[model samples]
Target: MKKSLSLILGLSLCALCVGTSFSQAAATQTVNLAVNSVQKIAITGGVITLTISNGTAGNNTLTPVSDATSTYSITHNSATPLRITANLDAALAAGYQLQIALAPGALMGTSAGTVDISNALAASAVAVVTGIPKGADAGRTITYTFNANASAGILTSTAKTVTLTLTN
Candidate 1:
């Protein structure tokens, strides 16, 4: 009987230890997360064409041509305000002019409205959209106007690159 009692006590203690060990079994891991700054800009719509082929009778000044078929979209998360600037790859010749305008989006930025960027360069870019907040502005219209005086007669067909930049 004493042997049987000692065996029963040992079994009970062993069961208790096993249950405690099973209950204490667990694992943990550390997870990390972060978000980086984002700044992006894109242009939509295909190539645009502007031809000056009309003028008033007996008028020395040829009529200006305009095309507004292009659009631009932007996404930025800057803490402070940002701006959109425009420039040409090369300056227009004398008596020829190229102008541009951007329509402002809802709560996006303020439009400069019809800026002459004929001779603008990267170092001296013209600001087309200013006071831009941190968000996405989509489907904003881009207008380009081309003009030439009578003095710049019969200029051969030429291509000029217009560059739009988003900056501080």
Candidate 2:
């Protein structure tokens, strides 16, 4: 009879120890929702729109970035770089210099968290900020001037409908 009693006590003690161990483990970690991974994609023939005021005009020779070549894209890699180019209509008597630069803030893109430019480009990319570095021609486009082979490494995006916003 004593052996039977001792066996029951031993089993009860084992059960208590297991229950305490499980409860202690559960207290340390917080339960969380499962995380989902995202894949990124790119598009072609993205739109480039300009809304410059006459104020943007300078030297009585404000050269506009031709719609033909005013386009940019992010090439994904360990460090994704941007491909931005532009053209000026006429060369200035002074021999102009045109360059690429990021705009002040995010422009409106059809996609989210972005006003303009691809979110990947925007998130991973940067703005021109008027006085900051990153553009080809700093202030304005010089007539008959051309600047090419400019690149900028931006963050990355995971949305479609990328748009580009450039400024003087």
Candidate 3:
């Protein structure tokens, strides 16, 4: 069964928790949007983080590219996703081109962006998920995972952050 990882972004916050529940009828089960803002944060600088992790067994792809309907959401708590993934390829793969969308209104680092650690595979990357969202932080470090397959284990970070600097 495919699992989901939830993220609470826009602040110096802890990692987001994600999960998945499969229904026998889920194959054809019509799903809807259910959002709960457990927290919120303002963009003080061109930097934000979303601590995220893969579900058990390290299988984090909510749905396979082959199946496009597989859907998931990244809850920003106080802020919105900026539809960052708005520019992401619906289906991600190994060595495939990624359009990683930074929050539309949110700049690369300030309003909204991500620090790439493909070369510096963090705890999350080592876990084995192919792709990750932006501004992913845990404590003092915000990192994102990339497609680190057996052939290429070291991915490089574009280190794209909010396009502009921010002032709370």
lDDT, each prediction: 0.90, 0.32, 0.28
- What does candidate 1's lDDT look like per residue over 98-125, in tens digits? 9999997978999999999999988889
**In candidate 3, what are the lDDT values of residues 89-158, reduced to their tens digit?**
1233454222221232222233234433222222222111112223342212222333323332333433
Query: In model 2, how large is the Cα lDDT of residue 143?
Result: 17
How does residue 54 of candidate 2 score in lDDT? Answer: 28
The list of candidate 3 runs beyond 4 A from truth reads 1-85, 88-147, 161-168
Give the range where candidate 1 is weakest over 10 consecutive residues by summed lDDT. Answer: 41-50
What C-alpha lDDT does candidate 2 achieve relative to the native structure?
Answer: 0.32
lDDT of 1: 0.90
TM-scores, one per candidate: 0.84, 0.22, 0.17
Evaluation by TM-score, superior candidate among 1 and 3: 1
Q: Per-residue lDDT for 16-83 in model 2, tens only?
A: 99999888763466789974432222223344443222223234334333333332332222122223
Top-scoring candidate (lDDT): 1
Q: List candidate 2 segments past 4 Å from native.
A: 21-78, 87-168
Q: Name the 10 consecutive residues with the lowest summed lDDT in model 2.
A: 108-117
